[model samples]
Target: MSSPVLKPAAELASTNRTRHPNESADYRRARQALLVEEIELRRQIERVAELRRALPEGGEVTKAYVFEGERGQAAFAELFGDRQTLVVYSYMFGAQREQPCPMCTSFMSTWEAKLPDIEQRVAFAFVARSPIARLIAAKKARGWTRHKIYSDTAGDYTRDYVSAVDADMPGYSVFTKRGGRIRHFWSGEMGMDTADPGQDPRGAPDMDPLWTILDTTPEGRGNDWYPKLGY
Candidate 1:
């Protein structure tokens, strides 16, 4: 079925702008052009989301994965609770690392205040290779209260969904339960292997708000600096 027609982005941009008094005609023209592109970008994001939601039924999750969680030992399906959809994030803490990954920590810090709102729509949790106690300590150090966490103690879930060979990397995955059966819905696949030339690997529609905020500034996200767990 065809989607409804929409107004052209350029028309929308041109019709709704309020100008800065100091701006010149040349600046106005450039700003108007950029606004048009911004409108188009917003539309493209919606289109991509539609495509993602329209994907065919994903593979069934038959493996019996378990984790050490707040409720002690819980099976994979238990993570969903009453919600049909579950969003799991792989945290970059492992038995071999002295500290959790700063980049992952930074990404997660933004999620602190947003977790309550997010959980209203879908079940959410963080899974890591570190023992549950260590992960809880890290969360306490960060001063977060609402994050649901789990340890992939056997690494079975991480190996199948996040990495092979049990690499300490972050992953985003969604699963859905329907008619008493759970299935993998989606997981981010972009990474270093698929990085574009002259750019560090990152997910499109970047999930990290820090980079999103930095991108709006004149300096942008520079090459040298990265977030650290401590100052």
Candidate 2:
């Protein structure tokens, strides 16, 4: 009349399943080594974050540069337009480049969709080291009319923010303002770590939640992804 006792998982293991003896010991050792390496990499990332948090306050802003905006043109101070902080993403699209950088294009595609929410928290804009007319023309061709765009043709602003190295290197930077003085805060020169090869030189920090959400789907953001302007 007593209830049957439950067996342990080990006892339920299938005895009939065949085991391959051809698997080399070196292969098993290599797999374990990779696992150990991954753990160490994660620790290194945490250390980098600690150092970032300890960084001292940056230099004060001294110069204002001109940039073209959605409503014609504006200056660096005007772009902030009264906001306490500004997040400028230095897009790689330029007058000389025939096509937009795929990695930057992907990030912008994600950022554009959440512009309304981002605008409420901080002033956001995209800057490029290209002529205003060129930037405008590219924006229209790509259909990114809603998101604010700007041109850093002279490279002064880009160099000041460390977003541009000379006339070739491309990057992004963020700034904060206090008592009428602006200071550099952060930046994203590298694309996301998971980004495809031949896209961007920098790797993106794992902060955005959009990637995780997209990972749940079967197609997984699909391989042939490309940014569509209006559609």
Candidate 3:
């Protein structure tokens, strides 16, 4: 049987379900217009995801990147842990910094609760420049139990995949070990350099749901506000 064709998002959005009684006609008209754009935005998100999935196979990784984790020293290949795909989040916790980047920490906090579900399909690990003990201490302090945290004590992985100068930066990278060969799949390359005017550089389909939720409010993520380490 042939698949059924779907109506355009704009057409579907035109049939908006409900409206606030207190709202003015001007508000409803503007909201309907916004709904159309929101529908287009949703479509754009799917298109981008499709393009990401269609990307060509990335370069193979030959280096035996070792990391210090709860299991002591482990090679990069061990990170996959039976999964074909591995996701490594390079945290901005370099040796010089006493604490981790608040932005990175905020994003990490969201993953803590969803790690189990996410790990079902792919291996996920967070790497930092601090020692294993320090990483553990922070993890304990933050009450992060699900994430398999690690320390890149040697700085080899950070320098190669994260920052050339080993600068404190947050990065997200995915690797795939298919057909008995491991290769770099993708990474969040956007940063300050790619940010638009009055906007912070962030990955599409943002990893953190905090921003997504705030975006739905009237006061969208403002320029002055940012996630903090503590209240």
Using TM-score, give the best candidate's number. 1
lDDT of 2 by residue, 1-231 (tens): 553664432333322243357877786556456545555566568768777666687777778788766577687877776688898877776666876676566667676568888788789878887777777777776677557888876778877765335444446667788887888877654545545665423343444454546655666645566444334
Off by over 4 Å in 1: none
lDDT of each: 0.93, 0.67, 0.90
Per residue, candidate 3 scores C-alpha lDDT tens digits across 1-231 of 553676787798888977887999999888888888888898789889878888999999988889999879999999999999999999888778898889889889998879999989999999999998888988888999998999999999999899999999888999999988999999988889888888988878887899999999989988889998899
Cα error, residue 220 of model 1, in Å, equals 0.5
Ranking by TM-score: 1, 3, 2
lDDT of 1 by residue, 1-231 (tens): 989898999889879668898999999998899999999999998998999999999999999999999669999999998999999999899999898999999999999999989988899989999999999899999998988999999999999999998998999999999999999999999999999888899987898999999999989999999999999
Model 3: C-alpha RMSD to truth? 1.7
The residue pairs in collision within model 1 are: none
TM-score of each: 0.97, 0.62, 0.95
